[model samples]
Target: MTMSLVFRNEKFSPDRFTGCIAERYQFINCDFSGCDLTDTQFIHCQFYDRESEQGCNFTRATLKDASFKHCDLSMNNFRSVNALGIEISECRAQGIDFRGASFMNMITTKSWFCSAFITKTNLSYANLSKVVLEKCELWDNRWVGTNVVGAIFSGSDLSGGEFSSFDWHSADFTHCDLTRSITSDLDLRSTDLEGVKLDSDQVSILVERLGIRVEE
Candidate 1:
C-alpha cells in the first residue's frame, strides 16, 4: 500500500490504527482526538500544524517537527526517537521514553509528562509552560537555550545534567534531585529541596544564592 495519510477531519476520530504506515507525509492543520494509533508507524512524518490523535505511537521513529496539541497520550512510547521542533500542548503523556532524543525547537504548553524516562536528550531552544514533569528521570540531558516558563519538574532526577542559559524564573524544580546539575542565574522561590542530593560546592552555592538552610 502507498504511504499516505488519509481521513483527516474535525469529527473524525480514528481508533485502532494498528500496523499502519505513513512515512514522510505532511499533515498540516488537522485535528485528531480520541483516536487509537497503537503500533502505527509514522517515520519522518511532518505534522507542523495539527493536533495529535488521542492515542498514537511514536516509538522508535523519526518525528522531526511534529506538533501534537490537545490530546491524551497516556502510556505512549516515544522511546529513542528524534523529535525536533515538536510542539505538544494540553495533553497527558505519562510514561514516555525520550532517550537520546534531540529537540532543537520544541514547544510544549499545558502538557503533562509525568514519570517519563528521558536520558541524554537534547532540548535546545525548547519552550515549555504550565507543563508537569513530576517524578521523571532527566539524567545526563542537555537543556541548551531552553526557555521554561511555569514548568514543574518536581521529584524528578536531574543528576549530572547540563542546563546552559536556561530561564529559571518560569521553571520550577520543586523537590527534584539536582545533584551536580549545572545551572546559572536560576531564580528558584517555590522550589523545595528537602532530600535533594547535592555536593558540598553545589550546596554552598544554593545556600548563598537561594538562602536555603542546609541541615547537617
Candidate 2:
C-alpha cells in the first residue's frame, strides 16, 4: 500500500512523508539513495532532478526523460536499459555497468566513471563534456551524434566505432586506439589527436597533427 502511495503518478516530494517510505514508496520521481529501496524494480521511470541512486540495481529498466544531474550513483547496474534524455552530470558512477544499454540525448558532464564497464553501449546524441572515463570499457560501442568534448578516453579502444554530427572541436583522442573505427567526415578544426593509433590513410585527412608550414 505504501509502495503504491509513492507511485502516485506525480513528482516525488520528500515533504509528502509517509514513514520509512522506500519500497514503501513508488514511482514518485524522488531521490532514493541511502534509503530502504533494496532490490527495487523501476520500469519506465522519469527523473527530473539529481538522484541518489547509490548501490541500486536498475536492471532491465526503461528510464525515459530522466535527468540525473549532480547525483551519487556509485556502483549501480544499468544493464539492458534504454535511457533517453538522461542527464548524469557530476555523479560518481564508479564501476557502473551499462553493458548492452542505449543512451540518447544524455548529458553526462563532470561525471566520474572510474573503472566502469560500457561495452556495446549506444551513445547517440549525448554530451559527455569533461567526463572522466578512467579505465572504462568502451568495446564495440557506437557514438553517433555524441559530443565527447574534453573527455579523458585514454587507453580506450574505439575500434569499429562511429562518430557523426557531434562538435569535434577541442576533443582529445590521445594515447588511444581507434584502429578500424569509422570516423568519416568529422570536423577536426582543433581536435587534439596526439599518440592516437591510426593508419597512414587516416593520418592524411587529420593534417592538424602534421605541424608543417602549409598554406592557409
Candidate 3:
C-alpha cells in the first residue's frame, strides 16, 4: 500500500476478512456492500491506481455468496459489482478489469437473469469487454489474452477452459460447455457454435482447423 494510499468508506466485519492475508491493500471509494468474503486471501492487492489511472471503485457492491480462494486478484477494479453468487477459485486473475460487473437479476424491466462461479481462475490480460455472463459456472478458467469483445457467455459451463489467446469470435458462446476446452483458437467458420458442447478430441481439434482430416 504505497504511493497515495487510500481507503475510503471502509466498513468491514463479516469476520473481518474471513481468513485474512491482504498485502498492498488500497481500496479507494470503498463500499464493500454485503461483503462476506469467505476464505479471503488477497496478496499484492492494489485495486488499481497506476499513476492516477484510478480504479478500485466497486460501485453498488453486493458480492453475493462470496468466496475468493488462492487469491491474487491482479489489477482489480471490478466496476459496478453485484457479482451474484460470486466464487473465484484458484485465483491469480491477471489484469482483472471486469468492466462494470453485475451478473444480472432484473426479473422486470424486460426481465433478466445471471450468476457467477468463476473456477480455476487465471484470466490473463483480463478486460472482459461488455461483460454479461449468461447461465454461468465457468469451469477450469485460464482464458489467456482474455478480452471477450462483447462478452455474453451464453449458457456457460466452459469445461476445462484454457482457451489460449482466446477470441472465439468475441464471446457469446451459445449454449456453451466447450468440453475439455482449448478449442485451439476456435474458428468454426466465423465462430458461433450454437449449443456448443464440443468433445471427441474437441471435435477433432475443431475440424482440424477447417482442413478437416479426422479418421477413426
Candidate with top TM-score is: 1
lDDT for position 65 in model 2: 39
Candidate numbers, best lDDT first, in rank order: 3, 1, 2
TM-score of each: 0.48, 0.45, 0.33
Candidate 2 local lDDT, 1-216, one digit each (tens): 223333322433323322322222233233332232222223323222234433455555555434343333444556655554334433344445555444433347644334434444455644465555544455555576665666667766676666666565545566777776676655445566667687655666566545543353
lDDT of 2: 0.49
Per-residue lDDT over 13-106 for candidate 3, one digit per residue giving the tens place of the 0 to 100 score: 4455655556557665354544555445555455544565444444455566566666556666676677776788877778778887887888
Task: List lDDT for all candidates, in order.
Answer: 0.53, 0.49, 0.73
Q: Compared to the true structure, candidate 3 yields what TM-score?
A: 0.33
lDDT tens digits, residue span 1-216, model 1: 232654333333455433455555544434433344444555545443335533234444545444443333343445445544344433334433344444433247654344344455455544444455666666776676665576677777888777777766566676677777886654445444556667787767767786676676
Compare candidates 2 and 3 on lDDT and give the better one: 3
TM-score, candidate number 2: 0.45
